[model samples]
Target chain A: MRRSLFPRLGLLLGLLFLWLPVLLLAGYAFSDARIPFQWGGFSWRWFVALAGNERLLAAAWLSLRVAASAATLAVVLGGCIGWVLARQGPFRGRPLFGALAGAPLVLPDVVTGLSLLLFFVLLEGATGWPAERGATTILLAHATIGGAYAAVLVQARLATLERELEEAARDLGAGPATTFATITLPLLAPSLVAGWLLAFTLSLDDVVVASFVSGPAGTTLPMVVFSMLRLGLTPEINALAVVILLLALTSAGGALLLLRGVLGRR
Target chain B: MSRPLLSLRGLSRRFGETVALDRLDLDVPPGEFLALLGGSGSGKSTLLRVIAGFEAPDAGQVLFEGRDLAGVPPHARPLNMMFQSYALFPHLTVAGNVAYGLRREGVARAERHRRVAEALAMVGLEEFGRRLPHRLSGGQRQRVALARVLVKRPRLLLLDEPLGALDAGLRERTGFELRALQRETGAAFIMVTHDQSEALALADRVAVLEQGRLVQLGPPRAVYERPATRFVASFLGGANVLEGRPDGAGGLDCPLLGGTLRPAETLPEGCTACALRPERIALRSGASGPNTASGTIEEVAFRGDDSLLLVRMPGGAVLRVGHAEEDGAPPPRGSTVQLSWEAAAVVPLLG
Candidate 1:
């Protein structure tokens, strides 16, 4: 209309510059004020002192048990390694299994959290098993980097499915575990619930792979809001970053309403 | 007796250096609907994916009723394919894709909701089982892929190009609702099409195939009036050849313009073709016909209740007649017309 209202007002001022710092940490999480930038008014007082903050509820129960065990082991090992890299084909170490399953998306998350904390300290000095690096080695190092972004978004949604609908579900009798639990798990339920809520929002927003395979009981919830924003921005760290941004916006609005009811019924 | 539900015997495959099924043999008797046909790289959907065991036939035997099927995979093949992309299951709904092969044949949940409500009321989609194959309609996802292979009553079904993506008016009412759902689910269906009028309107026997062998297996009117070669007489239709040598008494007297024809007894001794069927040629003028002659009209066409023409004969070949008179002798182009027929209506053919 008038150059579409100035590019929709510069995309609503670039989405209010990424939601005005999560709307000022959800308005100072009912600010009563531990002297947060002035407006010492409305009081939930850091949501009632973050309900008796016993070490910030033990780092929000070690980030909800390592983001629900690294989003249920990254949705069952990134859905059987994204359905065997979408029905195996490229053969012979398919480019070294697609660069070691997309090298945790181009390395450097502190070099994949210091080489998975030096391969869990050389597998606990060779086979002593996990033997502590905490929260089961930060849920096996955030299920190997959030199962490589849930196996690259469930291998780009199993490359638009149809391996002849699993050979028409193995020609309609369905073996191989009932053709993968009744037709490839209900046709990969919206990319397995958006790759398990993007691997539980990347293991509840990892603090650089829990600052290298954390210890002393794997301090999670983004390493206690990165040590309460290095002891500064504390309105009880904006009420635990507005309750982990309303639990990652109610799991990304229930994974966008289960991916709009599975892409509106396929 | 029931053993011929699907046999195969010498099936073969290849793929690497192209040969998608060579020594292929077949049988499918049980309820027998069997169509196969050919054309695009034949091996008719690779012999319906090696009789629905989702393929794997390097050398022979598939057997089924007689049992072999070797590693018998495709979900322990009792058989059920239907796929020319009616692979339905887009996250199930038409009664969960017709109770997904009746709950993989374990059946029960009230006999899988009474055989997925009697196979969605035998494809007339009984309220289309709570809709979903993208809210149905490619002929209701081809009758919900024929109510998911007629709710798993599979003794063998296969299909492949079952009415290839419909619409030629729902492939003429899904070729009689797939020959009345293979005669009300009698079973042994077999399919795979390259559409020769959908294998002559739903075969009772039609095998054909080409680059992958089985040159001609019979019945749809003996592969359309005896075609065993010259690529099954031009892939099943327009015939009209003529060729030379051999004399009368139904031997090889191929001279058809001024009579004296009859050549099909496997025309050999210095052989040539014959096949005529363009409404058994009959355009006469100064006809004291033995087989009459003359040629000139070179091309006409018309086609609506028939017209065709083409002519050019008097030894310079070109036949193609077909008439039904939309103004009969409007034969102008180079005109000179006269063509006739009836030395036992020609037909011989080989070249």
Candidate 2:
């Protein structure tokens, strides 16, 4: 009985350790106080003020656009790399390709951000495209890192899928291209969704990579929040946190439902 | 008969140092059902894959309808395979899976639906068209896989361990249905299996493989009754093999039998062994006769209709003798018994 109690208590403590800070921030979002954590009473003034802040709103919109684009790009790039690694049998440079595909995932964010900044500068010098770093640069940088993560997820999922499914399709007179389209792609849909969500969340919350890539015109929401932290804490920042947390939770729950619904039918 | 429908000549495949198939040669006549029987790692499955164009042989020629299938891709092959796992598309309904091949070949939607229904009905899965594979029973999934291939209307069909996944009762029933379906479709079938009884019951001809080489191939009864090698003798029906050399007096001096065995057929040159099926040996109570040996009953096993008695001779060699339940109670263990068989029942085996 004591052994069981210890594990149960450990599980509770683990949940609290992860969620206590977010719950406190959410609680402070409803506080009617000028100071962020100083609770006066309960109110919705900070949420209304956040809605009216034009600069913050613009930053939020820009971050949303960047995250959506980065996530889409990551899925495309990562899905292809994962498919090749999992299905395309052994080939020359496979080890090198595998190591390179995983490089962005293991590299520190500071190192990745600095190297990407230099790369963008060199590309600008070579071809006058992406002429000053901004949202486009931030999107590309986020996609590179996110693609590595998505590739790992997608590769793991593809590895577990039965190869016989594809073989059976080929035996049924479907060409290679048709077999992949009809069998492999549909089976990969769940992993692709999960990968896209992960990439979106990573891009949405990333500050270090975005700061190094963004120019004067490309400040994102996390950058705004970080800058605001340097000044002083505001209840409006807590309100913004609460809003983003709700959005993340809702989308995660919806994704779970979608996956469950699809998988349940099988 | 006519031209061989599928001819495999000098087929050999190696995985690094391990040989999966070794200089295998086989021919399947049109509409014939052939079963490749072997133990694990016996190259039966590899042979099916080579014929299906999934695995390339290291050196060989696969001729389908007299055309060398050297460069042909699997999707372009004129045959289909029902995989051992039954590889049903989890996302597609039964009807959708059945229609997949027809749709790939550019069949009209109306015609494809008609043919899919016919195939489903052929497998007695007509009402299961709208159900996904995972929602069905294992036997139903197997039928759906069959329907998927039958709808393609290939001249040849390969079945890789078709009923390996089912329980014994379901396996027997499904195997019967599978044989009936093959006859109804009239497509040549080459099935790979390790179950010798399944091979004998269903196939017109059985090819027994061992260590990647064809050890014996003939009609089921011929291969079962007159196994050419010691391996085939023990493997097919657990026949008791007695090692001996020809005595040059038209008899085999077998140490296990404690006497000479004069089989009905002329022994091949250098023949060193003979096989006797368990059922051919009769058990008696008292005095011994010609072609009889005295032994103590070591064990008895009851198997529904008949009981098998294990008789140990004085030479420490044990022989299995089948005693039908209708033949009266089996002799109990530790009892002295006489084991006898006619000369015709003793099959001479080559080394």
Clashing pairs in 2: none
- Give each prediction's DockQ, rounded to 2 decimals: 0.27, 0.62
B258-310, model 1: which lDDT tens digit per residue? Answer: 34555334454454566666766777787753466677887888777878888
Q: Taking the tens digit of each residue's C-alpha lDDT, what string does model 1 give over A124-182?
A: 89999788888888887788777777877777887887778878877777887888777
What's the TM for model 2?
Answer: 0.91
Candidate 1 CAPRI grade: acceptable
Scanning candidate 1 chain B in windows of ten residues, the lowest lDDT window is: B257-266
i-RMSD per candidate, Å: 9.3, 1.7
Q: List candidate 2 stretches off by more than 4 Å.
A: A1-33, A38-48, A91-100, A118-131, A257-266, B285-290
